[model samples]
Target chain A: MKIELDNLTVSYQRHPAVHHVSGRFMAGEATAIFGPNGAGKSTLLKTIMGLCAPDSGRVRLEGVERQAIAYLPQQSEIDRSLPVAVLDLVSTGCWQRSSWFRRVDRAGMDAAWQALETVGLADFAHRPVSALSVGQFQRVLFARILTQNAQLILLDEPFNAVDARTTEDLLELVPRWRSEGRTVIAVLHNEEHVKQYFPQTLLLAREVIAWGNSAEVLTDDNLHRAVDTAAHWLERAPVCHVDGSAA
Target chain B: MTLALYDLVVSPFVEFGFMRRALIACLALALSSGPIGLFLVMRRMSLMGDAMSHAVLPGAAAGFMVAGLSLPAMSLGGFVAGVTVAVLAGLATRFTSLKEDASFAAFYLLSLSMGVLMVSRSGNNVDLMHLLFGSVLAVDDAALMLVAGVCSVTLVTLALIYRPLLLESLDPVFLRSVGSRGGLWHTVFLLLVVLNLVAGFQALGTLMAVGLMMLPAITARLWAANVGAMLAVACGVAFASGAGGLLLSYHLELPSGPSIILLAGLVYLVSLVVAPVGGALPRYIRARHRQL
Candidate 1:
């Protein structure tokens, strides 16, 4: 599915986190949102997922409903210490089909098991999430996303604390999802990983620094500009009144 | 020995109608409040139950002011007051700089002071004592009905919202991403908490109502491995405490509310040392085994 951000400006307490920026992610594309810390990368994804209301502008999905998108927020956002089994956590993805009240049927359970198998956590299905390591928990989360079967997937810093092997294992899923005609948007920190995997990249520092081919967007000049822009970000900056111009 | 056991345990409940009513009231409160308390512990809002119990005081006092010692009036007033505190605390957390626990603490303290002031200003210490420390032996038919009704509603509502509530507790962001309204379920959960606290206040009183809710749940958390097991254990603990406390009160002439809460506290303390899951003995054993 294709997604479009039209002049999106999201703010926290009237301070714009994502400034006026507009772009469209084409169908079945693998895109990485790369920027310095606090550059509104996660906020932009959240706005698209309808978790955050933008201060201005809007995010429009061209060919999918909101439920057709699955989001994996950063690991910090999830309470992994909760007393839930891996299989139970993954089975929640069937909520779209089961909604609120209906029990997850045999087929849904099978799907959850299949997702766990794919994520290599089949033996740990009954294990409580608190028993899993950071990487193992991330795999469990990805397994949940697999069960979601969404046309669009948004991942925020999916590999922050993951080890090398687990990172590579999860990295393999991005191309597979793209091949299966799904759009993947990830907020990434590693430039090498982005250049190697993602074909398109949006370099943002609260506003668009670059958008297009990954190699082009990750240029030395653009990278420097993103860091500089983020470093000099004023905490008490005045609200933007400009019409369709970068703040 | 058997005859003494029967006289100590079953005779009081069989002999006195008020004792029977009190036992049933305890059973009803345990049935509903146990599961709610489990959720509170799981949500790390154990103290929230205490705050809500205090918040119910002003409303119950108001009800008592309107109609002295009436079940319906007091319960309605308590429910309204508890919900208002919950909502006001929620709004303060959402809109203001105050965090949820801090806001809850502030609101509940204010409610407690207001309730105390109102009760002491108009009525004598006897009325205030009755409002604060409920008389389980005085649980009349109307009080019994109210407690039972609240229990029924709490159980049914909890069953209906069980899935969403679980998801909301464990992974709210995921629940929200899937397009479900986690906030709505959270509000509903809070409402159930207030309702259960209001029901509990009828027998345990405002001071000790949360004791029945939290102690059993905390004890259960130490013993149970999962949510289902925790809920079952909590209910069992609550009922056992209620029954044991009632029997103890019947024989010793102690206050029923304090007796019940003290029994639950004893259970919690015992569980803290002996429960297999995260108890002190288990951890110590594990450490010794590791050294070996």
Candidate 2:
């Protein structure tokens, strides 16, 4: 699916975290969003996922319903200490197919088992999430996203705090997803990983700094400019208007 | 032997009408509040449970003042007051700079003072004590019926919202991403807490109602490994403690409500020290082995 952001602005408590930004992520393409700290990459992803509304403007997904979109927030957002079985957590991905009150059918359970096997967590299916290591927990999360079977996947810092082996295993799925004509947008920090895996790149510092091929967008000049923009943006004061309209 | 067993264990319940009434009421509270307590502990909202119980005080006091110890009046008043504080506290957390726990504390304190003032202004000291402590032994048919009705409603509603509620409590961000409204489920869960606390207040009194919900659930957590098992263990502990507390009250001539709560406290302390997995005994043994 092709995703479009049109002059989207996200503000918290009247301070704009994401400035007026516009871009389009082509279908079947793997795109990476890079930014300095507090550059609003996560905020932009949240707005696109419909979890947070933009202060002004719109995010449009061409020809795909909102439910077809899957989101994997940062690992820190999940409460791993909860006493939830791995299989039970994975089965929740079928929330769209099953009603809230109904039991998971045999077919759904099989699908959850298959997802677990794919993530190399079949043995841990009955184990509580708290018993798993950080890497295993990340894989379990990926397994849940796989069960979502969404055409559009948005991941925020998917590799953060994960081990190299698990990262490689998860990275292998991204290109395969692209091969299947699925759209993947990820917020990433590692420049080398982005250049190796993602074909398209959007460098943002509260606004789009550069958008194009990974090799071109990752230029030393653009990286410096992104840092400069973030530094200056925080220092700049808000302009007061007589009519009191500022977003 | 059978006669001896019956006399030791079943005689109090079989022989005394008040004991029978207390047991039935205790069972109703256990079956309903136990699961709610499990949820509360799992969600790390045990303090919130205490705050809400205090918030329920004014409503029950007002009900007593107006209707003279009528069960429905007191329960309805408590429900309204608890729900109002829960909603306001939630909103304060969302809109203001205060955290949820802080907001709950502030609101409950205000609610508590207001309730105390209203009670003192209208009723006698004994009336205040009854509202504060409770009168579990003197449970009438009307009070028992109210507890039963609340339990039925709580079970049915929890069943309908079980999956979403579990998901919301464990991983709310994921639930929200999947198009399930986590906030609505949260509100519903809060509503259940309020309803259960209101039901508990009639027998345990507002002062000690949360003990029935929190202590047994925490005790169960020391033994059980999963959510379902924890809930079942909590109900068992609650019921067992209720019976034990009632027996202690009968034999020793102590007040019933405080006796029941104190028994639950003793059970929690025992579980903390001796439970096989997470308790102190195993940890101490492991330490000794390591030293050896």
lDDT tens string, model 1, A1-247? 5688888999888878898989898779899999999999999988998888988888988789986688988754566656789999999989989889998988899999999998899999999999999899999999999999989999999998899999999999999999998999999999889998899999999989999999888999999999998777567777567876343
Q: Which pairs clash in the backbone of model 2?
A: none
Q: What is the DockQ for all candidates, taken in turn?
A: 0.71, 0.64
What do the candidate models score in CA lDDT, each in turn? 0.90, 0.87
Among all candidates shown, the one with the greatest lDDT: 1
TM-score of each: 0.97, 0.95
Candidate 2 positional error at A180, Å: 1.7
Question: Where does model 1 sit among the CAPRI classes?
Answer: medium
Residue B203's lDDT within candidate 2 is 88
The C-alpha local distance difference test score for the whole of candidate 1 amounts to 0.90
A129 in model 2: Cα distance from truth in Å? 0.8
